[model samples]
Target: MLPNVTVNPAAEKFMRRMVRFSGHGDGAGFRLTVSAGGCSGYSAEFTVEGAPLAGDEVLAVGDLKVFLPAESRLMLDGVTIDFSDTPTASGLTFFNPNAGACGCSSSSGTSAQPPGVAKVDISSIRRN
Candidate 1:
């Protein structure tokens, strides 16, 4: 597993509540990775998996397990996953210290745009 990645307690609580009903025969946690998509050249990907894959590094904090693939280790270091009940939006959010510039669409329906880092600071939104 990666030695420097961290899982905040707020994120752990959110994960526990979100996955409590998931019928995973084995333990269940999320896998984080980077893929070529979004407005930026790379985008962060997250999926709930039954267990860590062959090359996955499992970051176990509290009862939460976040599986970070070996390929994403460098880009995801010092990243923090958190939950907030902000007035505009609320859910699991990723704040990556390694990201240079990124942005995500805040629009709805077909008018949505790809994610890219922008200077806009929406008080109710979170960025990666």
Candidate 2:
């Protein structure tokens, strides 16, 4: 089953731009791959693709199409995806209410993430 993922306005806008400039033509969509790792328990990478790959499910957000792999579908269940463009960091941020605080710490001995928030840095969109 497809996960109940929520894409906030910022994220949707970002995705739309990616698909528009992907140079893949009309049917192109944004492909997102997420995994369990990082201090906040999530890491992600995205690219533009003409269609969904094997085992990938296409998530339709209005006219936008998001190709999500199986692992990403599972991980994004009940999660909210948002885009952040601040002076310090600019990327997609995932917020999972069911997630707990990560036990990992940085050199300062403090957690890198607060709790239930995972930030994925998409410094640039790589063409595939």
Candidate 3:
């Protein structure tokens, strides 16, 4: 059974390091949310979470906890969050199987469907 959203070992390790450096106690975790903006038509935002939200689905990877809202579950299903520490770039990158034309990160999971492709009003999607 695949999880709604999964975290890689590297991400968990990175989160551990972040908690140690941030001076937050063991209760520190991450909040995952989707907003309408990124080039892919949606954006993924991560914030520090002191506690779980009222109705979020929490995924525990190692000792780290990731909070995902109910609305974001479908878009994030089967997604894997990984961390990298290369000298040039160091951050968490999301690997979404449903991704399309992703410049950075997305929650829609794909490029905005063309006007003719679907009835979707691409213009209605605001830009950031």
lDDT of candidates 1 onward, in order: 0.57, 0.87, 0.56
Per-residue CA lDDT of candidate 1, range 14-102, in tens? Answer: 66664564556358876667544444434655666788888888777766777778767765566565665556555545555555443
lDDT of 3 by residue, 9-83 (tens): 887776566555555567766666664454544456566667778887777766677667776665566666676
- The residue-by-residue lDDT of candidate 2 on 4-90, one tens digit each, is 999999999999998998789888899999999877778889999998899999999999999999999999999999998877778
Off by over 4 Å in 2: 107-112
By lDDT rank, best first, the candidates go: 2, 1, 3
For model 2, give the RMSD to the true fold.
Answer: 2.0
Off by over 4 Å in 3: 1-3, 40-42, 102-128
For all predicted structures, in order, the TM-scores are: 0.60, 0.92, 0.61
Largest lDDT belongs to which candidate? 2
- Model 3, position 112, has a per-residue lDDT of 35
**TM-score winner between candidates 2 and 3:** 2
**TM-score (C-alpha, index-matched) for candidate 2:** 0.92
Scored by lDDT, model 3 comes in at 0.56
Give the distance in Å from residue 68's predicted Cα in candidate 2 to where it truly belongs.
0.6
Cα lDDT for residue 115, candidate 3: 22
State which candidate, 2 or 3, has the greater lDDT. 2
